[model samples]
Target: MKKENLIFGIYPVIEALKSETDLDKVYIQKGIENPKIDSIVKQIESLNITINFVPIEKLDRLTRSNHQGIVAITSPIAFHSLETIVEEVLASNTLPLFLVLDQISDVRNFGAILRTAECTGVHAVIVQKKGGAPVSGDTVKASAGAIFNIPICKVDHIKDAIFYLQGSGIRTIAATEKTKNSIYTTNLNQGIAIIMGSEGKGVSNSVLNLVDEKAALPLLGEINSLNVSVASGVFLYETVRQRTQ
Candidate 1:
């Protein structure tokens, strides 16, 4: 059964897989144990498609009809290659700005961030393929159609993308509260890739250690943190302001 981008039921998903369907991710209910499920899992693994094991209730909420503990979410927008986007941008003679998302699981935040990235003239938005939020219909709606306007790259690892951007002469900056230096004092006019982590944990320690610089948003109001999307806008527009000023 197809509902928007979702293709549910066991046979339907198997058919989708056989048809070389472009699925964003497939969700299988956890701890069911079946031969067909094992076969489907192996097939999905062989194709390198993202698969998630979720609770039965999740599959229930995803669709009211019989799902057989399987559902596939398809992406509305085609993803671009990071190397291609970087190469095209470098050849253009424009200051490059890229947004790298680490473990951003919320579709709304992802969409809002994409909107902000597009508005700020970011060259491309990079996200880890498996761990990040799936580009579902909600994500497209949340992005306010900006997902279609901007180039998005899905990478295997966020660190490798950071390394490539760094090799390309673009500074990798992680937005984290761990650093005392704020965004206002940091240089943003240069080619840079800003890494925004999840809302709850901020940037990972491993990622924080690898960045060229770590900058924080000043928190004088005692909130300690800002929503990832809001923080992204502030950082992006700061770069915009610096460039315009």
Candidate 2:
């Protein structure tokens, strides 16, 4: 089995940039600024590649190579464009089912939700580019490889994504505990995009305000809420049930 698939060393990572690859992220050693490095950073940024500034020690821990102060991890699956996916799905004249995540950073939860999304026949998963968990190997494993089958799009902002989806004729639903409407009652079978918040604080106010519907899963238990992943499953399967019926 391939135990590790990290592309370390500055040159190797730079070379990977030329090929058709989805890079999860790149780590650059702190305080190392040169023209060559600056140009490479610009290239990555231009390509919408995510980069992280880290200590050299961290790079060493990631690999034993003479990394020359850079490391890049290849994503298990290529990412899809939110606009393209929405346009194509809508062009099919079918009601699109999209899942928009705002600030959910836990890898396991992200992966688990993605697995449920694929099984539920979701068209795409939309996430904010920043403050989101890196789609690493662990996420791929946790997702049971569902990440490869489903479309995932990283957006600069959730609110912008909401507006874009709305303009594309997709209804945005915010899943929050504060809402009185039940998820089961919502029309998930239609052209819908569900927005799920972070595990810690729930959805942001800005994002929530833009949602066409704010619904919640019924809390029959005394806990008052469910884990984000479990809640996501409930929400996604509800859509599946509605569409099948």
Candidate 3:
């Protein structure tokens, strides 16, 4: 974490939130209570940003300067509103192609996925505010600057995004070996959102239960799975293959 990426002190964070700055998360020293902080917390909740109640020692490690019991990490890219993206994509002639990430913790993996998503013309990416990698400089590098070319949305949970997409008439599918359905066998020519899970856990059972469909890439190798990024690319191109035909 670089010093330039951090915003410390009370009023700075309040202004950042009010101005709709791209913030990854906020760390507040536990036991510090103030009315302004209460307002900040409310704003954070409204924006669906993550809030961490860390100790002063944690805040110290983040910055040598006074953090005033609160420090916020700025995101390298601004986030799009999920509703706005959905409405724009739905109203357009372009197909509503979205990628929903379920806890992709590796910044490198997340960036590579974004690269593939951009290359394949994904409308937008829906990611959870927490439990995922922050959009750091490394992420921007791995994305090959594709991060700027794509719109990303941060939500409180991925499942709710799936519901919104489904309600808007977009099909939601999960890429997991837990299902017998093959990606090639499944239809991807229509409006769809593909959910790629974490590198370790494929997809949470809760999210898996709500998705409209579950798909798996047929692997013949001894290893049962592929790296999440490679798998994401394969899934993305397959959709491209389907739609182009």
Candidate 4:
């Protein structure tokens, strides 16, 4: 986290939101309430921005200057629009492959997934505006600068993105342990978008229902699931193998 990337004070944060600045998250002093703060909360909710309520001590630790009980962290990189990226990909004659992440908050996991996505030639990595990990310095380092190379889109809802992708004739596949279908058995040589979920909750039921198919990697060990990043790599490489073979 860099000080240059943070914007504090209620009015400044509100203005940033109003201007449609790309923000990863917002922090407010817990239990503090005022008309301006109320308005900020409303704006954040309407914009679907992630926010946290923390102690004044935490805010002081974050910055020495007067934060006025509010702070906003800007993303290190700009986000692309899903529709715009999809249109560009569809215009190309080659089959399009995309990765959609649902609520993957761990910066390290997010970065590793991006690395794999770039290596495997994924067209774009889509994440939700609220629950996805911030494109912070840590994520950039973890991706080994691959974040700068790949297109990333932040959508308001994962379900809406799924529906839009399907409507465009791209097959959407979800990786989950709950499904009996295996990725090895699924066809990945066509235009597709693969959905990977959070570490704790996997994909949401609503999103799982919308995908064209659900597949899982067989786990030989006792562990029931793989790390989100590792599983994503497996899914991506499988796509590569099928397309190349």
**Which candidate ranks first by TM-score, i.e. highest?**
4
Q: Please give, for residues 1-245, the per-residue lDDT of candidate 3 as tens digits.
A: 88988999999998887676778778889999888888788887666566889889999999988888999999877789999999998888788899999999888998999999999999998999767877766789999999999999989889899899999999999999998999999999999999999999988999999999999999998999999999999999999999999
Any residue pairs clashing in model 1, and if so which? none
Model 4 ranges off by over 4 Å: 1-9, 24-73
Relative to the true structure, how large is the alpha-carbon lDDT of every model? 0.89, 0.86, 0.90, 0.90
Clashing pairs in 2: none
* lDDT tens per residue, model 1, 136-176: 66778999999999999988899899989999999999999
Per-residue CA lDDT of candidate 4, range 1-245, in tens? 68988999988887898787987678899999789998888877665567899999999988889999999998778888889989999998889999999999899999999999999999999998776677776788999999999999988799999999999999999999888999999999999999999999999898998899999999999888899999999999999999999
All-Cα superposition RMSD per candidate: 4.9, 4.9, 5.1, 3.6
Q: Number of clashing pairs, model 4?
A: 0
* Clash totals in order: 0, 0, 0, 0
What TM-score quantifies how close candidate 3 is to the native fold? 0.78
lDDT of 2 at 4: 54
Cα error of candidate 3 at position 198, Å: 0.6
